[model samples]
Target: MEGKRLYVGNLTYSVNEAQLRELFSKYGDVVSAKVIEQKGFGFVEMGTSEEAQAAMDALNQTVFEGRTLRIDEARPMQPRREFDRGGYGGGAGRRY
Candidate 1:
């Protein structure tokens, strides 16, 4: 929808955003589709809640390219943590 995206998982490694968009566009207008190269998962943004709902209804368990896609409402990203914040050499609780 306007402020939300769908989390699509179990996708083929070689599949890209365009392929995702093309597949989902059948349900409605897809605002954007991005496959995170490192994580092997991706997100799809739709124009409206209706479109998102439609996509979910039809594709939640659909098999594509030898994998069944798991689609769900995307959650907000967790806040970032400093990589070395509480480890051996950093930050507030240093051992004596």
Candidate 2:
């Protein structure tokens, strides 16, 4: 959609990068694949947006590793904003 990078969700914890590559490769060239450990999700970068779309179209609702896959364009990560908690320097700590 937006770019070649695609966000692959609804994955089982056991799914790995190589599995992703193998699955996506059917639609087109898999540029890269990464499985976020313990997150049950990963990223797959196809050779082009068209490839990504094809993969998404074919595999979005398909079951893999006992779970339905959710494929879509990866969104740019938003920067985390740090909030300032009032300067309370280690208030009298007594094991709660």
Candidate 3:
């Protein structure tokens, strides 16, 4: 893929960082692994893009921890937009 980071989804609640790292190490050197607790997802980074692709190819749609894993290249986070405080142009023609 375009990046070495991978998005690992459909994870069981019990999976941890060490377990994820170990699971991916089978494909290549795992740079990092983090399982988001209670989120049923995580991120795994490999030493290189090739390694990450290999992991994704081998692991995607496979069963792990009693669930099918969904693996793919992780996308970069976009900046969050500021929340709108009110609707109707902030006034709605009503005066305070």
lDDT of each: 0.87, 0.89, 0.92
Model 1 per-residue lDDT tens digits across residues 19-58? 9999999988999999988676899998888899889889
lDDT of 3 by residue, 3-78 (tens): 9999999999999999899999999999889899999999999999999999999999999889999998999989
lDDT of 2 by residue, 42-96 (tens): 9999998999999999999899989999888999999986554443443444334
Clashes of each: 0, 0, 0
Give the true-structure RMSD of model 3: 3.9
> Which of 1 and 2 is ahead in TM-score?
2
Which regions in candidate 2 have their CA more than 4 angstroms from the true location?
Answer: 86-96
What range of 10 consecutive residues in model 2 has the weakest lDDT sum?
86-95
Q: Pick the candidate with the highest TM-score.
A: 3
lDDT of 1 at 59: 95
Report residue 14 deviation for candidate 1 (angstroms): 0.5
